[model samples]
Target: MMPAKYYLFTDGSVNPQSKVGFGAFLLISDLAISLPEAKKLVETVSFENTSSSKLELQTLLWVLAKLDAVATEVIVYTDSQNIIGLPGRRIRFEKNNYISKNGKQIANAQLYQEFYKLTDRIQCSFVKIKGHKRSLDKDGIDRFFTLVDRASRNALRNS
Candidate 1:
């Protein structure tokens, strides 16, 4: 059976001080026709990390874990091309033990491995969006992304 589909907008940032924060909003509808309509959850996590990419992956893991695999058909909207590219790189990463051709361990290898396992357990996909767009120029859906963008960066500042 096809899983119920959901849309998730996510963003993460890392400050110079190595504080990282991730923001994500989950919606039951494909499009956020109204900011409040069918919006399920807004999640934020903050911690000390040097890599925005790692924080991005961790934020995703946190959200999907909260859903507990019930909402498996999630369309993840994010500005991170690395997250968007994870699936395509999976085969190579797995084949090489998440090591680079130079025999060096890849950055965020553990998180990527966990994500690879999660993809096997459930279903999800990625959609890359432009980041840091001016608020006034955004439409219905993008406004929510702006929300996430702020929330994530706010975490960095507040913590």
Candidate 2:
């Protein structure tokens, strides 16, 4: 019998500039090994004029819900450094009024709340990757995020 395949998903986002932005990745081990490589989950997102941390948290919530629906274990990764720094960073949303204490919370609190609710459903880990330190594949993550950010901007303009 073959082991389950794990999933490693990476995601990122951009703010409206001069504001906070976030980027993160997820890893799901103990999955059906016959599934596929872990990289297929990699993706990036973009939100205008939003906090990076919020964006990062939003991405986390999205992935977690998806994972729960599929019943998978995951370990998320991110280059945000700050978000992955402390534990339950997003959980602290209640303290900062759904945003970090230092910045404005995202406009869509309900979305974050819906996703945050899933924290209890699965086991997950948040890891920090040093930026510009050549310590955690920062370049690759940055490039992926940048591409997504630009694409998002273009999409908004077109719409």
Candidate 3:
């Protein structure tokens, strides 16, 4: 039997005018089972006075932290390029002492550090997905993206 593949779709919504944000995630599994038989996980978190980028990165990190050790292979989809770019930028940040071009400490330094630490424990990959649009994939993975997007936005509205 083949191992099950785990897919996580995450999104973050922010209202700059109100300084409110929310992060959401949907987890799906590929198994030879009926739709009802497959477990679906959906969750959201709300925060105030945070940037959308921070919410995005936080959602990704949150999901990673929630993943079980048995989940050997997992893929995470997010609309945030900042979150996707972290792995490549992490090395440079460490070499530069986490300093930015303006000599300020890199933004979200603690979150990025936690994200990196989680990556060391789980064999996972991060993929960038376009937001506020329907997905073109026939496999229906895009549905999860849409789910998280709506959930995050709703959380922002209610928070």
Candidate 4:
């Protein structure tokens, strides 16, 4: 029997007027899910004085927390290089306690710490997806990613 499939596509954008970052993610169990269906699964949040990286991490933590009690795995798709690069930087982050050589905390160190802990406690992986692209594929990966990207950028458009 095949295990249930889990896929999460995420994106984050900062509001220029308020510097409030908005992040959105869509989690689903079916690869054939449509954009309208995926929209129902999308979640959004805003954080004041936040960067895109922090927003990305926060959204990740949000989805991580949404998982059931059994510590199920998830495959995350995102446009953020920061999220795509975490695995390569985990060693340095752990070695230096999430600090830089300048004796200061790395940007979003706290969020990264929490994300690291949660990730270690669960099984997860990351997939890099193109953002704001005008291309579509037969697999629908691009469709879901495009939906998430728009959601993050438009979440607080009126504010």
Q: List model 2 lDDT by residue over 1-159, tens digit each.
A: 322333444445454554544444534454342223433443544454566566766666756666676644555556555446444555566677776556877566666566556745665565454433433554544443333344434433443
Q: Any runs in candidate 4 off by more than 4 Å, and if so which?
A: 1-5, 68-71, 136-139
Question: Which of candidates 1 and 2 reaches a greater lDDT?
Answer: 1
lDDT of 2: 0.51
The lDDT for every candidate, in the order shown, is 0.74, 0.51, 0.76, 0.80
Taking the tens digit of each residue's C-alpha lDDT, what string does model 3 give over 50-82?
Answer: 898988888777777767555666788888889
Error of 3 at 142 (Å): 1.6
lDDT score for residue 66 of model 1: 66
Highest lDDT against the true fold, candidate: 4
Candidate 4, lDDT over the whole model = 0.80
Candidate 2 at residue 147, lDDT?
A: 39
User: How well does candidate 2 score on lDDT at residue 51?
Assistant: 66
**What TM-score, to 2 decimals, does candidate 1 have?**
0.84
| TM-score sort, best first | 4, 1, 3, 2
- As a TM-score, model 3 comes out at 0.83
For candidate 4, lDDT tens digit of each residue in 41-77? 8878777887777778888888787674544678899
Q: Per-residue lDDT for 1-159 in model 1, tens only?
A: 434777778888777564555455554545735666533356677646547777788888877776654765778888888899999999899899888988999988988888887777657888888886777887666777877887776766776
**Clashing pairs for predicted structure model 3, backbone only:** none
Kindly report which residue pairs in candidate 1 clash with one another: none
